[model samples]
Target: EITVKWAGSHPDNPLVKVILRPGMQMQYLTTHEPDDAQMECAIAAMQTVLAREEAEAARATDATEAIAAS
Candidate 1:
């Protein structure tokens, strides 16, 4: 779900790259400039994902501790 298109014809494409999954070696480049709203939405989505990951990790840790205490 990349928010940008390819840098095919844009001579002055921005030199920005976003790595979504380093383990899987997945990366994306944003050639076209995104609007302010789009950028904000993207940022929000990323933050949400990070929060979910953190919450899941915390839950897993708690469960492991509980099992160990039993």
Candidate 2:
């Protein structure tokens, strides 16, 4: 699920978007001030997604090789 909430008046609304997908591609951008913690969180999330994807790929490769050998 994806959600983008607007908080404020019509002319000044701060939008907040959230999506939970551990193994999905994602990109983060901002026009506001720089936040170190936010960047760290993004990096960590990306690492988790990449690791999961790699593991899944390895599993599929193993299964394919086994089937071929059989």
lDDT tens string, model 1, 1-70?
2333443344355542333234225324434588999999999999999999999999999999999999
Cα lDDT, all candidates = 0.68, 0.62
lDDT of 2: 0.62
TM-score of each candidate structure, all chains considered together = 0.54, 0.54
Which candidate achieves the best lDDT against the true structure?
Answer: 1
lDDT of 2 at 32: 60
- Inter-residue clash pairs, candidate 2: none
User: Candidate 1, overall lDDT?
Assistant: 0.68
* Candidate 1 C-alpha error for residue 13, in Å: 23
* Local accuracy of candidate 2 as per-residue lDDT tens digits, 5-69: 32212324332212323222343332466599999999999999999999999999999999999
Global fold similarity of model 2 (TM-score): 0.54
